[model samples]
Target: MGWLAAGEGYEIALVDGKVAARSTSGRSAGKQLKTLPKALRDHPEVERLRRFADWLDRHAASCVAQVDAWMVSALPVPSAVLGEVWADEAWQAALRDLVVVGAVGEGPDATGFLRDVSEDGELRVVNLDGETVRMSAETVTFPHPVLLPDLAELRDFAVELGVAQKVEQIYRPTWDKPSDPNQRSSATSEFAGGRYPSRFALAARAESLGYRVSGGYAVHRIRSGGRMVEARVWIGEPHREDDSVTGGLSWSSGGRHLPLDKVDAVSWSEGMRMAAALYAGRTGER
Candidate 1:
């Protein structure tokens, strides 16, 4: 952004997402100041720049959140939508380098890291073969890591290419369900018994990590295999000052508790992931 006259001899503009000032005269003429000048602190131009910077930060965060939701839900996004938003810097930052697959159709069905979206809604991607390919599919999906067939290989290749994604994808941790029916239980106690100073502390930690606090549990909802599943970890009562401990992790569908054996893979992994994250924040862990 170009500098705007702020006060008497200073001009202000956004530098690295912050309001910066420069003198238009004297020894410091045209030199970016290390700090905003006191006179320009309350200037209308400076205030407006600060407000704009704040909006940019919020817009970037919102973009990442939306992309994260799409990845978690494995929703199909239209190619036209991608092209429409690709011009926005914040949206491009969040969508670039994400792994995407063409929705089942006659168009290119291969999985690759998204690179570009043309004005005509064509997608350019770096395929597993280390080749750039164009996909003209009507829609594409940002598959969850749990559903990616070549997740491990993709991680290694991403490292080789020095891919730094704004949204967590290839490097996101995952868990697998036990295949043996004998080992299944309605809920797992692996992350249970984690102590917290107070119920509020545990619940606050859950909320800080983007989980919803409900009743006595921290819940993470996932849509998998066309079913809505909720993974919940017991975090004790709502009493703010009452000491609490974490409890077993479980999954439910349509208000009915599900056996670990019956929970779908994505649901099972997400539930365990939430339980483990909550446990990791407990007090005095050895």
Candidate 2:
């Protein structure tokens, strides 16, 4: 699902899991309000709109996660698959600007923005020279960074042509799935901000960095000592928003807490990195 901004006189509306503003009669409410009138803001329809907006946001994140998974796995996505997904506006928007190297009969050659997929399943690519090249490959893989042999050259090419990928391309992180799920690790880390300006800012930053938001904590997966554990960073408490002190970062594997020192070097650094980003956004003194 996706969201489209309303034309006029509305906040938001629900459409096939997507959101738009409700176009209704009366004065087209355009002016910004510090606060909304209770009657309108608290209306049942308006509440539904709020819920839809939240769903739309989650859906967008999910899309990013799915694409990231494909890239990480270096999965061979069939041309048909791309065509089907392109039918959805949201998916198309997410994939439009990604770089692809089509697996032609000879080998992977045409590399550029996946401009279009024709009806007969032809991959239309705009090469570095800005020439359109049609390619036919039974399977097209969104190569992992390690697999992109010409990554440096491609980066230089993109820069020369002012080609900016809508989805992250230059620096997409990838990791092998945990090999041993039963491995034990008693690692922990802590993140504290003196205070925060707003919970929204903290949450948005965490989500942007691909952390899962839940129970007022920003949770991310990290591999520590051969174990995959979740690192949870606190956003704030129910009543803590106003004063907004941060201090609840923790690590757990199989529901067991691990001490910060026990965490592996990579995992420990990742946890602190997330914490530092949130802390830097605090409104009060660090």
Candidate 3:
């Protein structure tokens, strides 16, 4: 739903499962998500994804006039010593570039830069005390060495675009037990399956650009007729922000009809609270 809201679509449901466990072959440091499915890779959605990437590139070009260049060597076949190194003029130059990139369309200032030589690779820093670490080409799958400020610029740009355009969220739902019947004494008796109700909603205030949350309302039961999925939501009282009520806090029974494929997740009050908390933490304050 989030992706669709961003004016993009996904062919496959993104599963948050570990595709691979421990492996002798040195690759990623931690477990990674499964690879993209063929359907997703070849879907029309790729075009939309490319457009998103294009936005990043546009932001990058606008934010920074020039980016730093670094030389890197792979591990094991190393010919140089592996250890920390002191700051240098090259580091200062890189740091300046980052500052310029970070402050695009804003003010300008030079932070600090430092360099660190390590066994993994030659770590370059453009800011003081290694505030901004550099990733070389060899370290990342992508050809470019991702810069903190550059990535931040892209994010900022995306938010700006999203807000200005009023993007719609893409909905994708996957249920654990799609065919399971709802339990007795449940609120959703109208439907054949007494299945639990759930919703994966991505909504935010008009002021915000990007969707601030991945929310859901755990359904008591959802009935599928034709293309619509009637979702029965157990409403909680709206959330309170200071004196104002941001969302209703009533536990009243209500229902919403949405596309069958658009359901992102089952919304439970507890789960929604957690998700809201996470969003608040990321943005710093509600």
Give the top-scoring candidate (lDDT): 1
Please say which candidate is ahead in TM-score: 2 or 3: 2
| Candidate 2 C-alpha lDDT tens digits along 1-286 | 3332433444554554533344344665543334444545556666767786687677776776677556544566787777777766656666765677666554444677677876556778767677778878767766555456666776777777676554666454422223343322211223475466667666777788778887678887764344677777878653344555556567777779876545554454456556666666677875
Q: lDDT of candidate 1?
A: 0.88
**TM-scores of all candidate predictions against the true structure:** 0.93, 0.52, 0.17
- Give Cα-based local distance difference scores for all models: 0.88, 0.62, 0.28
Model 1 off-target regions past 4 Å?
Answer: 105-109
Ranking of models by TM-score: 1, 2, 3
On TM-score, the stronger of 1 and 2 is 1
Per-residue CA lDDT of candidate 3, range 154-187, in tens? 3454353332211111111112212333321231
Clashes per candidate (backbone, < 3 Å): 0, 4, 29
Listed per candidate, the RMSD to the true structure in angstroms reads 1.9, 9.2, 23.3
Stretches of candidate 2 exceeding 4 Å from the true structure: 1-38, 104-109, 173-286
Q: Distance (Å) between predicted and true CA of 190, model 1? A: 1.3
Ranked by TM-score, the better of candidates 1 and 3 is 1
lDDT of 1 by residue, 1-286 (tens): 7989878999888988999899999998999999987888888888888889999999999999999988988888999999999999999999999999996765443689999999778999999889999888888889889888899999999998889999998888888777776555634777898888899999999999999999999999998788899999999878768678899888899999987667988788788888888889888652
Specify the poorest-scoring 10-residue window by lDDT in model 1.
180-189
